[model samples]
Target: MAENKTQATGASVDEFLAAVEDSVRHRDGLRLLALMREITGKEPEMWGPTIVGFGRYHYKYESGREGDAAAVGFSPRKASLSLYGLMYGPEAAELLPRLGKHKTGAGCLYVNRLEDVDQAVLAELIKAGYRHVTTALHSP
Candidate 1:
């Protein structure tokens, strides 16, 4: 089986966020960093190069593929903020409509800016998704 490429790294999350060239992305990245920290109560770690991850979970599939992944994470990409683990569980389906302007792809939620969405709704999504992944989907 192919190993997961995005593994945890010892890189500094603050340094990475500071290096983001776009002012809006930089600001939003900082905001997300703080918000995720408060929500997960877990210190942030760099997952590979770009993703800022909070907490972790291990998974093994029926095919015997297994790996560890962030319980929830986000990447402040140039195009948009790629939010991971926030689109899982039944709560996602119910909350997504109320999350304000955004787009979803595969397992990620993309938001152009933090101002484009309701922060409270985003917080709820993060909390619910974190709970679902850590408790229901994978053991943390």
Candidate 2:
């Protein structure tokens, strides 16, 4: 099986966010860093090169592939801010409509800017995702 390429790394999250070329992205990154930390009660860590992840979960596929993934995280890409773990939230369907302008993939939520969405709604979504992913292991 191919190993997960985006495994957590020891790189400094501060250094990575500081290096973001876009000022808007840098600011948003900082906001997300603090927000995720407060939500997950876990300090941020670098996942691969760009993802700022908090907390973690281990998973094993039916095919026997297994890996660890962030319970919650986000990346401030040039095109948009990519939110991970939100897709895992049960409230995603209802929340997305209230999230303002955005897009979603199988496991990602993309936003052009922080102002484009309702921050309170975003917070609820983040909390829902974090709760779902972190507690999935204990659910029967």
Q: What local distance difference test score does each model get?
A: 0.94, 0.90
Misplaced by over 4 Å in model 1 are none
Cα-based lDDT at residue 42, candidate 1 = 93
TM-score of each: 0.97, 0.95
Per-residue lDDT for 4-29 in model 1, tens only? Answer: 99999989999999899999999999
Count the clashes in each prediction: 0, 0
Candidate 1: clashing residue pairs, number? 0
Query: Considering summed lDDT, which 10 consecutive residues are worst modelled in model 2?
Result: 131-140
Report RMSD (Å) for each prediction in the order shown: 0.9, 1.9
lDDT string for model 2 (18-73, tens) is: 99999999999999999989988999999999999998888788899988988889
Candidate 2: lDDT over CA atoms? Answer: 0.90
